[model samples]
Target: MTHQEPPRGRRIPGIALRHRWISSVMVAVAQLIGTNGAARNQSGRVHLDALAYVLLLAGPALLPLRHRLPVLVAAGTTTVAAVYLALGYPYGPVFLSVIVAFFTAIGAGHRRAVLIIAGTVYTVEQLLVGHWLYRWLPPAGDGPTSWMTTSGIAAWLLAVLAGAELFRSRSERVARERRERAEAESRRAGEERLRIARELHDVLAHSISVINVQAGVALALMDEHPEQARTALTTIKAASKEALGEVRQVLSTLRAPGDAPRSPAPGLDRLPELAEQAAGAGLKVDLSTVGARFPLPPGADLAAFRIIQEALTNIVRHSASRTARVRLGYGPEGVELSVDDDGPSSPRAEPAVSGGNGLVGMRERAAALGGTVEAGPRPDGGFRVLAKLPTGAAGTVAVATEEEGR
Candidate 1:
């Protein structure tokens, strides 16, 4: 939902100065000509003169200030209109100014004031002027106004009030809808930012960890064993190439929103590649699965792959043990993955295992799909990471993409 911005002004722009001034002048002209025309036909009523013209113009002249001072303008217009009626002048378009003022006041959120002013005017016109003072008033021999006329005037006032209230309510509703839409857009932007951050962290952290380890090996062996150093170089090339590809895929979403990914996200199908990379880093990864394999949603598939990848990367960089174990279990409800290294954890790995973006990113990925990740030191040795992710139906998970701002 959307709303047009109201014109900016010192006061409520619903009754802008230009519009009020123009309307007031137009009303004054209309009342002058209309009252004269009506007076010609109703010969018994008091004829239009200088005093009557002043009163007719006076009510409309105050309309320009209604927004800034709603209660004062409403009361002033009502009082002037009541006085015009009491003096026995022929009634014509003089009521127009009163209508404009009352409507403006109510629309400006001064309904109570307008109501009180209108009610008082109605009472005075019906009781004092129409009934009691009609005899002494200018129209000689004029009798008290009939109850039917008073009832009609009362009904007219009520109708004006009702119409003004409706317009005010509709304006408020439009403003509210605009606010909700803005908040939704802001929330979407925030989610998109977090998704990009999380994806970048997972992608770079794992591949860089592999690259860092291989580079160290290549440097250590370059002089003593060129062949082994060359093999390490090859592993480094492969790891860097894979990392660049994944980074490109994740960033591609920013360029094209709501479009299918250039390549499918890696799933358990890439476990062999992960194991091979671990081997090059001198950490053997053992992969095993339980339960029948079934198709998983894209969000859950991507999350599981990243989790296992991060776990293996941590084992290669932080664990003293040479072997790491990865287990995947599929059930009717969800998918569970576990990565563990058996040995004492390296001193440098303590802070990472205890508190780092790797574990945080893994948990974020899993939680986005209503899953969970738990990582801690093993009882007798190294560290372990376990994640449980739900395999939801297609389109069920509303994962935020890198192109969220779009």
Candidate 2:
């Protein structure tokens, strides 16, 4: 029963008033014709009007208030019809206005009130009018019976009531469906926002960590090893540029017009660049692949790349080891990525590897795609991170590896 506000600047009240005016005018014209007694009676004889034309027009004039005061309007129109009939007006259909009022009342959600008011009005008016008609009209053998007239009027009223109720029910159903659709859309929008936030967090955290390490390296070697300091600076430049590109790509996806060209998401294909950047940041990286690589779904591909990137970034930042090995294994069911660093476990590294936002993000990504990720310190050596991701079917496979020579 909640009503929706009409759209702004549309003048809904004026439009409704205009429509009511048009309806009243049509009904008034019909009543005026009936009042003239030009229309024939059921018995083919003209029944001249004894009621004033103004009284006949009054029924339709009351119709404009039906929506606002349903019970009162319906009763008023019915009373006017009865008065016209009692005064011996030609009965060609002065009750048309009464039908409109009854329908309007029911359509405006005043069903019980309209029924009670209409029923009372009909009973009182019918009793008084029937008695008057019985005395004033011709013999029953020559004219229509009072029972037939009353039955016809009852049938018309019932039909109008039923039609209005049906229309109201349908409008309510359509409004309910529209509200449901809006709620569902809002839920989807919220989920998308969370996803975008996670993506931005993962991308920025890893890149910034790399840049921080390289910046430290550049500052440390500035006097002792200027050549190496320049190399660290170069690594910083490349990492920042790549980070900027990835950030732009992520932001472009959120743009409404989508006019900007989008860069492809990084995957296993970018491991060489990733390893080289890590090596420049003071960690030697050896990346290798086993078995044949197959095409992965976009979500699985992005998840795999981010997991690997996060693992490598963690090793470069926390591990004391100078060398790390990354093995990429492709199986019939899925792809496996493992990063093992030859760095001894430190108390600082334990907290980060064991319980950190990086690991949690990796686990979330894997679980979202029905995959799993494992990260812990190796028994005799450094930290190791392993992830397995599913790819539904096998396709054209390729293998590529980059191993740094000692």
Candidate 1 lDDT for residue 51: 89
lDDT agreement of model 1 with the native: 0.83
lDDT of 2 by residue, 1-406 (tens): 9999887536588888989989899999977875555545344433553445767788889888877887788888888877665555556678788778877777778889778876776665565546454456433323333777777867876787787788778867887888888789898787677667767877887778778888888898999999988988888888888888888877876885346547688887877887887777667778887876667888888888888788878886687787888898887668898999878643444355446678888988898888899988788778899998887654223322211221
Clashing pairs in 2: none
After superposing candidate 1 on the true structure, give the runs of residues whose Cα lies further than 4 Å from its correct spot: 1-65, 89-104, 136-141, 353-355, 392-406
Error of 2 at 183 (Å): 2.4
TM-score of each: 0.79, 0.68
Report the lDDT of model 2 for residue 18.
89
Cα lDDT, all candidates = 0.83, 0.75
**Residue 99 in model 2: shift from native, Å?**
6.2
Stretches > 4 Å off in candidate 2: 1-111, 114-149, 257-261, 283-291, 314-390, 393-406
